[model samples]
Target: MEKLEQEMPLDPFEHIIFDYFPVYVEADVEAFLDLTSDQEKKKCTLEIVHAGMKRAAQAFNWDLQILEKVYHTIKQTGYKSIFALLKKSSPNKKYVCSIMCHHEVKRMDVYVEIKKRSGIVVKKEKLFSVKNTDEQDLLSEYGTLTWTLNHKVEFADKDYKKVYRLTFLEKDKPEDLVWKMERYEL
Candidate 1:
């Protein structure tokens, strides 16, 4: 392994690697697994979620305490299980964005407050609700909670291009909508 390493690139960051069990999987190799089938889809989704979480941790340089919790949560709950990333100082940070949860299909319709622009949400619609009070307080302080969901659908709706406009009856603007993540198949 050391001999091979001498020939390989030094910067591990330049090349994305997936640490699957004991082996290192290149990004392209993992991407090839078909997620369309019933069983394969579930497994693939889990892998993607795990990879995304790891990437986020590495990118953010999250605190050791938070990182330790994330590791335990992923291991215990499994990659497909839903998880929350709570914000500490920023109220806008709290909320569940994990697509792995079953209830998310219905719950994504809700919204919360953003306190003092304390964190990273650039657009208001992009933010969603979480179980944390600080996150809710932040959202409440920024603006009242709203759900424009016709709540997006997965699998079934992946084929459609048009975004379904959802809005709260009390408001004039369509705040949210149901749509699928775009993918191109050649």
Candidate 2:
């Protein structure tokens, strides 16, 4: 694993804008299975989660302590999940976007909070509510999360052309899986 890490190029800061926690968790589990000692497994899990939390804190502009608290809550809840937080800005408005995926339940939820320049949230809305279909499972056979999205989905409505198109991995199948949401205005 150290050799692999050395061979790979450094990830840019922007890469953390995507949800990669599930992949890290899955890798840690696989590594744990190969280790014979309990101490080694514990160390592996802690290292993976800590690295992930660091990236998440930078991407979300959150304090590390806050992320640790959220991680503990997720651990207590016993749900394997991935999430991303991003901030966007326009000339007149600012927004905070959140995307969360629960692999066990095969569900993903997207939300946006519209805020003023002063950082007061004015509105919150659900941008997408999606579930894994038979065609696309949230977790691949290898146990890695396989959820992704394309930001450019065409819609007849002029107000919205950026509806998301989600894709996932097909369980027990090697073919790529895709699921397009029906026309729904945001």
TM-score of each: 0.24, 0.30
Output the lDDT of residue 183, model 2: 41
Give the alpha-carbon lDDT of every model.
0.34, 0.42
Residue lDDT tens for model 1, 1-186: 011111222344554546432223234333435334544444454454445555545545656567667656655664333323222222233322221112231132232212223343322233334343343343333321222232221111233332322221212333452223332232
Clashes of each: 7, 0
Which stretches in model 2 have alpha-carbon errors above 4 Å? 1-86, 93-104, 132-186
**Range of the 10 consecutive residues with the lowest summed lDDT in candidate 2:** 138-147
What is candidate 2's lDDT per residue for 106-138, written digit by digit as tens?
A: 346544443446765444445454565221332
For residue 93, give model 1's deviation from the true position in Å. 25
Which model scores highest in lDDT? Answer: 2
